[model samples]
Target: MPQTSQGSQAGEGADPAPAGRPPEHPPRWSWWLVGIVIPLVGIAVTVLTVPSQSPNRPPAPPASSSPATTRPPASPPPLPVGLFRLTNADSLMCLSPPPGNSTPAAGLVQGDCDARPEQFWRLRREETGTGVVYSVRNQHTGLCLSVDAAHKENDVTVTQYLCGDENGLFPDQFWSFRYDTLRHAWRLVSRNSGKCVALPAGSGDGEQALQEDCDGGTWTLWRT
Candidate 1:
């Protein structure tokens, strides 16, 4: 009791720490949690601030182009050959050579429309100019309408002659038929004289056919 020093009395007043250990400090994980939690909160704030797109919007349409072009049709060609009856609009009389005189130099006259061989003609298109010229031959005589020796004179009687001369030297033999749109009839024009085939006024059976200025009258109008 006399020797129990002051050092022993001081140790008993304060508790002693455990062996091989340091004094406790605040945990370092709190700072690490603060760093991780700050980034997570920032990401959540960014996600909530942005706007969302609508799902019901329609898509855009494509561009357009121009239209195409077009054209028209052509006209029909004429017939090459055919059998026909030559008649006038006035009397409807058939053209024929005087009975029993179907030879060359015989004159064409108006007769009954009786389907006789003399009344039937074989019309063949001449391969010459414009394909409008034709050789009008008698079925019975095998001759064609001719202008005496290819004469170009007026009032010259039209007669029958042999066919097969395509030289055009005798344009008298070639005849051109033109459709008169106004008159609604056919006009027989001579290739040589350029005059029209006409049935003279006061003409009857056995009368010779002649040429005259085109008048588009029934006398100059013919039917095939």
Candidate 2:
């Protein structure tokens, strides 16, 4: 219900602190050299290492857009829903919503393989107990992904919105990266319909699409 992001207040320009009158000089001592040199060294290191959080700098990488692909397909097919744990492992592959575009989500890429927040997901079974589902979350907005009822192929744009309605439910509303779990890698499956939803903007059409009994393409595979 809140905005995806908020602007921050930048530090305003300010005059440097004044150098007050010099106090009586201390008797020259060896320890004085150590104190002065050590402090100077420390200042230099801090200047060289500590980064300033001033807003004047370029934004810090839009807070890592997405997370890494998890799980391995090695023994995928027969595996139970929750056993497919996400990790820094690459035995996994993410499916782009079908049609054309390319480029993995930032968190699931080679660099971000851990349980980085953006890439975190949970596997779930439909409340009706008909099928399983996976969800990819971006904590920043507290939203998952929504579909443009018209998107039936690849290369479509994915927009951010609240995680609700059919978009937040299963069949077309899931992450399909693990093998044997039913949905394609990072694939979307519509919940109520038991239909495999395609993101024409993210990945491709699966080999086994069935006809839809509902308004949208019923190409869902889990139909009994």
The candidate scoring highest on lDDT is 1
Report the C-alpha lDDT of model 1 over 1-224, residue by residue, as the tens digit.
58888889878867788899987886899889999999999999998998876788677776656655555433333433678888887767888887768788777888878967888888877787556688888888988988777777778787888774564436688888877655556788888788887888657766678877777578898777
Q: Choose the strongest candidate by TM-score.
A: 1
Q: State each model's C-alpha RMSD to the native.
A: 14.1, 38.1
Candidate lDDT scores, in order, read: 0.78, 0.37
Backbone clashes in model 1, listed as residue pairs: none
Candidate 2 lDDT, 69-144, residue by residue in tens = 7875554344233323222111232222222212222111212233434333334443435444545444433444
Question: 195 in model 1: Cα distance from truth in Å?
Answer: 0.8
Model 2 weakest 10-residue run by lDDT: 101-110
- TM-scores, all models, native as reference: 0.60, 0.29
lDDT of 2: 0.37
